[model samples]
Target: MSSVTIEARHEAWPLREAFVISRGAKTAADVVVVEAIDGAHRGRGEAVPYARYGETVEGVIETIRSAAVHISSHADLTRFLKPGAALNALDCAFWDLESKRTGIAVSARAGLPHPIAKITAFTLSLDTPSVMAEKAARVPHLSLLKLKLGGTGDDLRMQAVRQARPDAHLLVDANEAWTTETIGAFLTAAVECDIELIEQPLPAGHDDILADIPHPVPLCADESVHTADNIETLLGRYDAVNVKLDKAGGLTGAMRLVAEARRHGLKIMIGSMVATSLAAAPAMLLAPYADWIDLDGPLLLARDREHGLHIENGIIQPPDPQLWG
Candidate 1:
């Protein structure tokens, strides 16, 4: 048997601009990365420890370290860790390391098709309606734009963005920021502005109210649906789910989510936190299964690592092996 080593560390990548969402604004994406060495081959994976989920970079790093002794293979991963960013980074690193060691592409090893370049949604950070419109107007080449919402003026915000970029498709993520009183108006605005999808309009536990509301525009479960264990509860309330690798414990749990989402007849949207291309690279492989692709993290960053995934005008090229699997 060859020697193997794995370690985790924290990294912070600056964003081109502050990414303001319903929860808050972040100028830098603080992430935890797991790097594994198998003999002469090396592989890496990244995950952003989101505060909304009560995760911190330090906590995630410790989690990865505690679980390092058990990093034997990818089977029965839940036995070692829970669903969140830490397990995500570890599992992703395992896949990358495996692909490198075995001389096989991750897509092939996973029984998926060859990964390809695909279009992704450019994000418009939450701001005043006019400011958001200005942001939308600036990205005329990106045909799909996902807006950060959940404020009181979402309807106006939607209208302004639409007026500014009528040609672009739109997805709205409220990040569990909306309330029962505000959902009605927001849904109406989404319909009026041709919003393609509305994500987590209400808080996770509070989203049961969604069952009573009419969804002229389809609603997607973000915070409400993490692992497939929560999919049953969201069936009557949600039309789709946004699967982020970090939330689903990397590609392992993420594939399970795709299977469960399909079995439950729910649409899929592959999403990511604002981080470097390393975080988005592995997640991009799921683009084939998603109804929408929102892995725009690299595009939001001020700079990415060498041999990062090439993204031009919101079009994402498959990640090079030098970067990850």
Candidate 2:
């Protein structure tokens, strides 16, 4: 194996507008891009550092830089770094580089079938009920819509969106904002509005509440579940798990998590943080295992990288080779 050279940089992609969720709002997506090169072939990957997990762009970049010196192979990377944004970028880049060097598609390398286009759930950022409804109305062509919900007035927000897009499938993500005391009313409204799924309705530690109550709508775990290690604990509480490449560390860890989640009879929802297509491409490979797909991160940006994933009428086509793997 040839010695690999690594390059890492930070990028701030401007969002078309501020994207708000239960936590807060941001006008730009701060991402770390990593490239691994061996001989002439190059593979690239991107990751968004999440502050909720105590990650900063500077911290993530430094972490990658520190590990890059010893990472001559993809397998070495897995042992060198823990699961997080930093390792996600490096791990994905290694996969991409390997695919390019071997002249093989990532799907084939991962022992998966060729990726087919699928309908992705476009997200409506958290806002007033009227505003969210208006936003949902603007994207009537989309069949599935993911709504970001905060604690208060969640009922009104769901009702408003359902009224606007009566035919659309609905998924709600609370992003660890709700408390045990208030989740009942929220779940009540969610079911009343015919929500397809509710994601992370309450914070991680408080997920025990889910086991106590009858889930009117199937609940999916996002912030509460990261990798396969989290699957066993979430079995009774969550009906599904949202696997994002960033959270699982990369495609390798994500595939493991998906298999583990399935073994426990839990549904899978492949999700993404607010990043570019480079980040979404690897996550897209996991869509076949997911019941709900939310790789609409690039669609939310003001501009995406060249050769980005093509999303027409909410159906995301497979990533072009130039985009990543």
Question: Each prediction's TM-score against the native?
Answer: 0.97, 0.99
Worst 10 residues of 1 by lDDT: 68-77
Worst 10 residues of 2 by lDDT: 201-210
- Residues 198-246 of candidate 1 have per-residue lDDT tens digits of 9888988988888887889999998888887888999889999999888
Error of 2 at 124 (Å): 0.6
Clashing pairs in 2: none
Write one digit per residue (lDDT tens) for candidate 2, span 1-325: 6999999999999999999998899999899999999989999989999799999999999999999888889889877899899989999998999999999999999897678888999999999999999999998889999999998888899999999999999999998888888898898898889999999988888778789899889999988998999998997899999998888988899999999999999998998899999999998888778788999999999999999999999999999998888
Clashing pairs in 1: none
The candidate that achieves the highest lDDT relative to the unseen native structure: 2
Once model 1 is optimally superposed onto the true structure by TM-score, how far is the C-alpha of residue 276 displaced, in angstroms? Answer: 1.2
Question: What shift in Å separates residue 88 of candidate 1 from its native position after superposition?
Answer: 0.6
Which parts of model 2 have CA positions greater than 4 angstroms off?
A: none
